[model samples]
Structure formats: C-alpha cells, structure tokens
Target chain A: MLYTVLPLEEVLEGIEQEPGPTVQLTLGGITVEAEPLGNFQARVVRVLSTDPRHFLEPHCQPGFLIHGQIV
Target chain B: MFEQPEAEQLPEREAPGLQTIKELGQTVTPGGPLAEEMPFHCLTIIGQIEGHLVLPPRNKTTKYEHVIPQLVAIEQNPKIKGLLVVLNTVGGDIEAGLAIAEMLKTMTTPVVSLVLGGGHSIGAPIAVAADHSLISETATMTIHPIRLSGLVIGVPQTYEYLDKMQERVIRFIVQHSRIPEETLREMMFRTGELVRDVGTVLVGSEAVRAGLIDEVGGVGTALNRLSQLVAQREGGMH
Candidate 1:
C-alpha cells in the first residue's frame, strides 16, 4: 500500500465538509474508518468496518490519539 | 633540479625548490596512500545535513548536487561491489534526502544501512531506503508526522504543500520497507510517545518487531549481508 504523510489540518478541513473516501485501516482486526475531523490537527479513526466487540481486544483499542495544531 | 648551496649560505630563494621537492616526496597518487591495500569500494559517511544553502556538522551533508554524481560514479566503477550507509541523523532537507534515497533504491549495487545511534524524522525514510537494513541493539528510531521547523504560514496552500511532502515520505517508506502504512501512521501520530508531540520512539528490537528494520545487528552483520547480496546479484547476472 502507498503511504503518504499529510498535515492533520488539511485532513481535518476535508473532513469538515463531507466524508471522502473510505480509509480502510486495521490494527489487529479492528478496522477503522479514518474520517477527517474539522480540526486540522485531528482525524477521527472511528470504528466503522468492524463490530463493536472487536474493540474489546487489547490490540484493537484506540491505538494512539495524536494531538497537534496547524502551524 | 638545482643543487643546494652550503647549508649556512643557502639562499632564501632556494627554499621554495627544496619545499617542492619535499612535497613531491610526501605526495602520493590521487588513488591515495593505501589505495591498493585498502579496497576500491567507497563507503561515504555524511555526518551533518543542514538544510537549504547551509552546510551541516561534518562541514557538509550529502547534497544532491554532490551525491548524484557520486552515485553515478559508483554505478560506473567496476571496483565498488556494494554500498554500506550508516545513518545517525535527525533528518535534513526533504528533497536532498529523498533524492539520495531514490538513487540508493534504484542502484544496481547492493545497499545496506545501519543505524548506529538515532535515526529520527526524515532519517527514518533514509534508513529504510537501502536494499537491506539493520540497526544496532542500542540504536533508536522515531516515527513522526512531517514537521516544518522555521516560520510557516498557516495558509491553505501551505497546508497542502506540507501534506503532499508528507505523502511522498510515507509512500517512500512504505514502498521500501516492510512496515505497513496504517501502522506507521499510528506510530507517527501516536501520542504520549513524545511529550506534547505525536510520535513514537522504537529501540533496536522494537524497530525490528515493527518491521522498520530487517535485523538487530551492527556494522559487521550489515557488511556481511551487503556482501552476500552483492554475491547473489552477481550470481544471478551469470
């Protein structure tokens, strides 16, 4: 898979309007929909693709929540 | 050659000739003093990588202007069997490092990288650019989102530019190394790893487990692997 680093703010701005593409991400069976948040520094990796039960797994929990502001 | 005058009466003008003779005796061929004894393969070390127009710590980092030529030379040179890169850097100019990494990725010669101390920031992409990668047991690597150091305008265009640059780095890393993009992104934006920041630090074994590095070995292992790769490539050619 191709990976790219993008500013959180740009992603957030995109998310503020409409949910773009379905970002399929998996952390040990916990599939998440990487939706863009209005805030540029944050993106909501909401659990969309997996059942709520998957979240109970130790590795499937919210892996990391990064916080930062657009510069 | 002019004969020297008596020691005490020698003219000062003769000093230059005498000095030239001494220099001639000391000077060796451009190949260097131990060129024959030492191997012809090149192992360039770039210590400092200050950005833009500025030169860094070792007086200079690997500038694309210089590095591109060197890579071409290495490719053409029959003596250079393989390339071993040792990185301990905080990352530098994005374009410069990317250019160097691109060359390394495409080079015919086997390339190996060893992270001696720390390979953080853009250095992450560079460390994985090689054909094979290794890290010392004590070395550390950091995965973080792109950060612009100097004054940055908060305009939409600026944000877009930064995003594009970030994508390039991520794409390169994911393509070259075994690490997955989403996993890397989690690490990049992972909170609590860096106080008041979104990044994670992985030690030697951790880096290996994360798939950022192939093995946890130092220079010796790195060299051995490089040599083996070269031999394999040569055998394949035949």
Candidate 2:
C-alpha cells in the first residue's frame, strides 16, 4: 500500500487547503451555482472517519441516576 | 385579588413588556415558545428556503438570512437546552437548505426534528440533520435529483456540476441518517415514480423503513424525545 510520509495533521492540512473548482457562468443575470463539493466532501469524510465515536455519541446530556447512592 | 401595575411598579410593567415581545414573535412564526420558558427552543422550517434570489411575493419563504442569525443566537444562548426543528417545506435553493442542515448537524445542542406535511427536494437533508428525526404518518418526503430552472445550455459541464451537487446532498443525508448512499441514489434517480419528475416519494412509515427518518411520530413524540435528550444532558453534567 502507498502512504505519504507527512504527519496526520499535515495531511489533513493539505486536504483542507486544497483549492476547489472555481467556475463562473452567467446566464441571463443568473450566476451558475459554484459550490466547492470536493473540498467539503473530503472534509466531511475526514470528520466522520477520525471521530466516529464522537459523531455517534448522543447529543443529550447523561441521564440522572435513578437509584440513590448508599453512603 | 389581582394587583394591577401601578405608576410606581416597575417590575409589573417589565413583565408585561416581555410577554408582549414573546406574543408578537409567536404571531409571526409558526411554532411558539412552550409554557413556563422551557429550555428547548422550537424552529419551524416552512415553505421555500430563499437564498440570494427573492422568491415571488405569493410564495412562503424561510429566508436564510433570518434563519442563519437565529441559529447563531440559539447556539450562543445559555438558557436554551435543546432544539425542535419542524419541517414542512417544498424545498428551495439547494445551497441554502444545505447550509441550514449543516448548521443543525454540527450544533452542540441536542436537536430533534419532526417532519409534517411534505419535506421535498433539499428538505431531505434538513430532516435528517437533527440528532433524532420523526415524521408524521401522513408526511411525505420526495427524493429527487438536482434540477435547474430556465435557460438550460445542453453542455456536459452542466451535467457534471449537477451530479457533484447531487452527490453532496446524498453524502450529507447518508452520513447523518441510517439510509445508505446506494439506496438514496436509487431513490434520487428512480424513474416512473412521479408523473412529471423522476424521483421517489416515501411517505411516513415508508421513510422509516427506508431508513431516511428515525421513526414514525408526531409533535408529542418529537417533544418527548427532545425533552429526554435535554434531561440526559443535564444528567451528564452532574
């Protein structure tokens, strides 16, 4: 398998910094949509993969203990 | 005996002023505040999500500019514990809908979404963006490919652009919801589903079965889930 020698943070920085497609098309005063999907998808993938546990963790706060602790 | 506000009574006057503001806001927005100033805030995403372009006057729109700021406030507000997002939209401006969905997905506060009526087009992502999502038994969600209106130049690049945009929507929905990417793509590209459009409309339990929605429920279920989340958070803090 091929791998880059760069550190994980550096690799992530590289992906984050990569410029996306910049296309400009004007049709009858309506500028064509030009969203940077490639960069966004890459970022989302990184977020999902690196922190699967975090993403899966429920957003709600921990529940209260129903039973009282015996001192 | 009821005590009225006197010229010397400042607290009484202030209370009524605050109530007036809340009442006025309730009049303008679809969902209002729950009784007794509950920590959970309710946001209604109705009609079209208007972006840079102004939709027709007759159309009902949830202007992105307005919603974006409200989201920021909800995030910053210390008193707000959770969010309840109610969606009933035909969807509009792909980017705008995605932006809202992204904000909701990334929010630290627990969010529970309930889809009533229809969640079509870009509304699909918004519905699934919440931590827990529900749909009414009669609610329907339309999964369709991205489409452009007016002056279509038959070019390969346009199709490529559309595909990329559609891919973003599918990626977001699959990442947030239980639905798989392949199934969502199939629904988006499905044929003979709509007489005029090429897409599939999953209603209520069907959406849950397809894994697009978390469960089949209504307002009570959505509120109960959100309250539970809030309690869970409070439990965690202690």
Candidate 3:
C-alpha cells in the first residue's frame, strides 16, 4: 500500500481531491488514498511500512486511519 | 461492659477491608488512591504503549485511550499539585507516545519524569516530556532511526513518510531536552552501538552527558524536584 498514517490535524486540513471513483487526500507530505471510515474520518491505504514496530514491538503496525472533526 | 462495644462505637460507614483493598490496588498500580487528595499524582508508563491497534494478550501494553483521559482529569483536578511520570518502557506506538508526551508538555501542572530501568525508542520523548527528568544510574536508553517491521512497499514516498515521522520525534526531543539536534541525530544514526541495529545506547550518566536526560537520579530525586516545583507554583499563586 502507499498510505501514511496522518495526524488529526493533517486529516482535518487535508486537500480534498476532485470528484472521483475513490477518495484521496494529500496530507502529512504525501498523497494518500482515503476511504471514508466514519464521519470526518478516513482509512489511508497507500503508505504501508513496518517501521512503527521499532518503537514498541510485535504489534506496532503503522496505522492508516485518521479521525477528528475540524472546528 | 463500660460503654458500647468498641467496634460498634467506631464510625458506621467505614469498613476495615476498604483500607486493605486500597493498599493492594496501590501495590498493583503505580498511582496510589486515585480519589485521595494528594500533592502529586503518579503516572507510570510501563510495557508497550498500544496506540490505535490492540496488542496480543500476552504482550503488556499501555493503552493511550486510558492515559489520555487520566491526563485530562489530572489537569482538571485542583488537588493534584504536580505529576510524577515514572517510565520503565521499551517504547511502543510512535504517535501514541508522542501524544502522551505532547499532553504532558502542555499540562499546567508540573511534571517530573523518572526513568528507572530502560527508556528506549519512543519512550525517549516521554522521558524528557517533563519539566525535570531523572534517569537511574543503571538505566539505559536506546536512540535509533524509525524502523518498519511489516510488509513495506519499496518506493520513494514510503521513505519520505518515514523521514517525516522521524523528524517529528527528533524535533520534539531536541526542543525539550538540552541535546543539540546534531548530537541527537548522530546518536540516533550511529552504528556498531547495537549488536544488530544502527543506533546508540547511552547508559546512566551517558544520557545526562548527551543532554538527553536532565540528571542522574532516582525516585527520591524526582519526588524532591516535583515537590520544589509544586511549592514554587503554589508560592507563585500566593
């Protein structure tokens, strides 16, 4: 996948793509393929990596979902 | 024979078992009596910090969900004069670690962190999140680059995303600690420090020398420092 786990701020301020078959958002310095998971929330499916495990171990997979409502 | 029975004469509402249970709970968890009016609140960050995902039952984890609400409550509670963050973790989710660190950074109550055993990886940021940080003489810290363990798409953008996340951690550590960005980066990217990894391991005074930790001390020092901060804050208010 080519998705990145975006912070809540990035998701709220993400640049929306033009109307298309799939949702996309440019955030956290990368263009991510987004799927609406909830209200004001999305699941990024583009950036996938095993880097997050370095912090913890075993189960620290990179997250793609970003959820937060903008004020 | 004299007056009423001694046990009956005691308060009707209080139970003796309550004290035993409270003591047992305190022994199990770091925070003593959460409801009790105390001068400082203890927040212990142990095991892996489970962020958005849930870890296996065998793996001990600290859920950010729980910590976040406790932080909010600690901030809102007027009785909590200060916060004592005790860290003995190997790090966990980066975002979750950063989230906890950020909340501590912005909290109005004074926070003091004490690194007991090992504060590695993401735990580094949290250890330095407090106004004053302490690391035990035998404690060690590992500084390394952000790594991925699962399936990874080999592409330029992937590395870019990783670099951005790494920068966030570096920036936060540099801003809060006395270590310069260059020195911290060097420690992070240094090789041969670990048997099979590309990073540096600082033990005890080394962390203090590297400017990552404020002092080389333990619980006594951390508590004393927190007391001073709480007193200063209270004094300022007066």
Candidate 4:
C-alpha cells in the first residue's frame, strides 16, 4: 500500500519493464549494486551495509562513481 | 544536485591514496586521507521507502530493513556524535517511514533532518521526527490525506481504514513538530493548491512559518547546527 504523494502511474510506470544491466559486488566491506560505466568503473545503484556510518562516507553514496572495482 | 568536489573532476586524483581505483574510494596511505572527520553519521532517506515487498529493480528504493539496522548501529556506536538525516523523498510506505521516524525520535543521539527537494505525504512525519529540521529555500513539503495509490479494497469499511491511517500520520506529525493540529487539518484539506490534488504545498519558509520545519536553510547551515547539538550533548555527558 503506497502512501506517497507521487502519482502511482509515474512511480510504477516502468515496473513491468526490464531494469537493464547492473552488477552487484562487495566494495569497501559493503555490498554495492551498480550500473557498469565500463572501463572498470561503475555508477552506484545502492550501498548496502549494516553500519550507519558507512552511509556517511562520500565514497559510498548512491549516484557517486565507484571505480577501482572490487567484486 | 551538489557536485562531488575537486577530487571528482580529475581521474588521477582518485588513486593518490587508493593504489587501485577498486580500493573502494578510501585513501589508505600511511599519512591518512586529508578529508575532514565528520562527527555525525549522514543517513540519507531518499527515493521510495520500500515496505513489505521489494520494489522492482527499476524503482529507486530505501529498504526499511536496511535502514532499521543502520539506525540501531548508529545508536550503539558511542563515537558517532550525532545523526544527519538528509531527506528528499516522495514518501513510500507508511509503516516504513513511520518506523524510521520512530527510530530517530527514540534514539539518544542528536538527529537533524534536512529536506532538500520534496518531502511529501508520509515524508512529513519523518521530517518533523528530527531534533531539528531544515528545508532548502525552494524545497517543498506537501501535506495531504493518504490515498490508496493503485487499488481500492471495495468495501464501505475501506474509507474507515484509510481515515485511520491518515489520522495516525497526522497525529505523528503534530506530536513531533510545533504545528497546531487545526492548522494542519486545514492545510491538508485545502483545495486549489495543487492542480490535480487537494492539499497545501509549504515551500521552505512557509513550512517554517507553519511550524512544520524548524528553519529555512541548506547543507552548510544544517551541518553547523548538528555540530552545535553534538557539542551540547558532549557537554552534558561530561
């Protein structure tokens, strides 16, 4: 049950479609799901960790480029 | 919308401390990285707050389970002085958002929430949950009745269910913030503010005036306030 103010149509517009290519790997002691930018670099999709401080790291933020790929 | 600073501009700088690009953006040289040490943890609550079901991969989501554990970890870490919650959310699941808000409210650590873009619907509760709340000059917060976005349960009792859910959210906001219950109700049901919806849009200063958010400011102001709060807490501890 969605309680958001955003229109459901817009939120779920692509729910049925394919999500394209992505890779899930462990980086900096955290799990990172990213969209490959090739040449060994990737744009962060999400940084997963149980530690809240990890989210504070500018390097682990979503949308920031995570290169020096560690799988 | 903020840039990643000078280091991001040049590729060579990324590897100065990190021997390889894959060393996870950390500077591991013996001298230590030049980055300033932040006293508080910066936890971002953005995109959709995924509830019971996993949102499809196409949707950007903040899973409740992921956040709940992190909140617990922050509380357990004594070195972490405060928490900076950066919210730019459309407000997904009610239970999830409220749970996150409740966690922040109950924690002993000082928490500051800053609304950057749009903190709408369920986001309102989370925004006011902070020890201090701030909104960017142009950021907005929409207060409205919660709607069943996709399906209707098709029963007379459904309205009651939705009403009860709405009440819970409104109650939470009023309990956390300085907003009067009556004013909140009026803003929520007010018409003409949104073309397709019936509600009031409180932009930055409006939200501050309405007592929904504590101040009108951005990242720098928020960080400064967070530092002050951390100092206050430390003074009390000693």
What are the Cα lDDT values of the candidates?
0.65, 0.69, 0.73, 0.83
lDDT for each residue of candidate 2 in A1-71, tens digit (9 for 90 to 100):
00111122332333334444443322223222232233211111111112223322111101101111111
Writing each residue's lDDT as its tens digit, candidate 2 over B1-238 gives 5664564556665665545333221122225443345687788888777775555445566777556656776777678889999999888777888899999988888999999998888889999999999999999998887765535688999788777887888899999999988999898889998887788999999999999999999999998999998889889989
For candidate 1, give fnat to 2 decimals.
Answer: 0.00
Clashing pairs in 1: A3-B171, A4-B167, A5-B166, A5-B167, A8-A40, A9-A40
Share of reference contacts found in each model: 0.00, 0.00, 0.00, 0.60
Q: Quick one: ranking by DockQ, best first?
A: 4, 3, 2, 1
Candidate 1 residue-wise lDDT, A1-71, digit = tens: 11113232332233234434434444444555443333422333344432434432323222233232322
Which CAPRI tier for candidate 3? incorrect
Docking class of 1: incorrect
Chain A superposition TM-score, candidate 2? 0.20
Q: Best DockQ goes to which candidate?
A: 4
Q: Rank the candidates by TM-score, best first.
A: 4, 3, 2, 1
* TM-score, cand. 4 vs. native: 0.76
- Per-residue lDDT tens digits of candidate 3, residues B1-238? 3553465565856656434333221122235564346778788898777776555434456778657767877887787789999988877788999999999999999999999888888899999999999999999888988875446799999899888989999999999999999999998889887887788888999999999999999888999999999889889998
Sort by lDDT, top down from the best: 4, 3, 2, 1
**Tens-digit per-residue lDDT, A1-71, candidate 4:** 78888788777875766555888877657776788887667877666665666755556666677666444
Which residue ranges in model 2 land beyond 4 Å of their true spot? A1-71, B1-36
Q: What is candidate 3's lDDT per residue for A8-63, written digit by digit as tens? A: 23322322433223465544334445556555556543332223212221111123
Error of 2 at B143 (Å): 0.6
Chain B only: TM-score of model 2: 0.84
